[model samples]
Target: MKKAWIIWLASTLLLAAALHVAFMFAYPYILMNAAMDRLSANGERENVWTHAPRMTETARLIVRPSPDLAYSSCVYDLSDGPVQISVQPWGDYMSLSLFGANTDNYFTLNDRRMPESGAIVILRTADQAITDEQRAAAFEVVDSPSARGIALVRRLAPSPERFAEAEAARVQEECRALNAE
Candidate 1:
């Protein structure tokens, strides 16, 4: 039971040294289904529910938008649900997030510096060992993921335009204050 509620933070050292000769966006049905069903079953009717479970992997389901989550889009909200998915803000590298209730352990896709409240995204690289295009988003710089896999977007942030706006406002406010004063 304890194993089903653990989340670990990966180190950046190993993440940087690792070479991505091939990249792929294979959304393991297990991770998505398991997280959805478990969360819905435990949450209110507004949330999504699932019956199937995820495959095996030494992974951690990272990424979230606070613990008030109750829905499932392209990505899973790690705060609630049966398993605890620890999410950090994405600074430089993109990642893939996986969630499983059986071994209920959430972590990054073999990396560190996870996003704080957004989709676990990845960009196109020379990683031939991987094959999921949706994982790579070198083209669709506006959407969630690349091609094959679904890019997780923040529900709080509306679609079709800029991502963060409050920051811009803050900057503008500062400028105005400086000029007026």
Candidate 2:
């Protein structure tokens, strides 16, 4: 009876360990889902960038957001069609990152990678093939695995005072849904 009780206890511990591991893995998914929901509620519908206020001691949208950087985000729904992003690299440090529904960052580009045209146009193609017109444009095309996602534009501000400059730069950026034609 002693040996049987020990075995049962071990089995229970193992099951609990497995369950904890599973929850650890699922935690990010749950958090991302909640964040997406909040973003949809707060952000402009779709394909329009919404600049977030500068991070402060009271600000809590992103976990531990840095005051040294400014953020702008756009929720994307590519089920109907692909989306295009146009950015003017203005700051000393700037980056654009694409995050899928699962919170996985699939693509990122920084100021160093900015095109020579003084602007960068990125096309996130849906699961389907791109149109001939999209091929004709001077845009960087990338096939996206997920149709619903978020586009984040981050810019480094040298000081809290510079946040406005970064915001100004990002406000000029454009996130637009491409026409099916």
Candidate number with greatest TM-score: 2
Q: Go through the candidates in order and give each one's C-alpha lDDT.
A: 0.28, 0.76
Question: Tens digit of lDDT per residue, candidate 1, span 95-161?
Answer: 4333333223332342243334433232222222223453362212122121112222222223222
- Model 2: per-residue Cα lDDT at residue 28: 76
* Model 1 spans with C-alpha error above 4 angstroms: 1-38, 42-97, 109-112, 115-132, 138-181
Q: What TM value does model 2 have? A: 0.79
Q: Could you give me the TM-score of model 1 versus the true structure? A: 0.20
**Looking at candidate 1, what is the lDDT of residue 74?**
30
Error of 2 at 165 (Å): 2.2
**Candidate 1 at 94: error in angstroms?**
15
Give the runs in model 2 whose Cα sits over 4 Å from its true position.
1-22, 42-44, 118-126
- Give the per-residue lDDT digits (tens) of candidate 2, residues 36-107: 667667444677787888778898677878777888888887777778787777648888888887789988
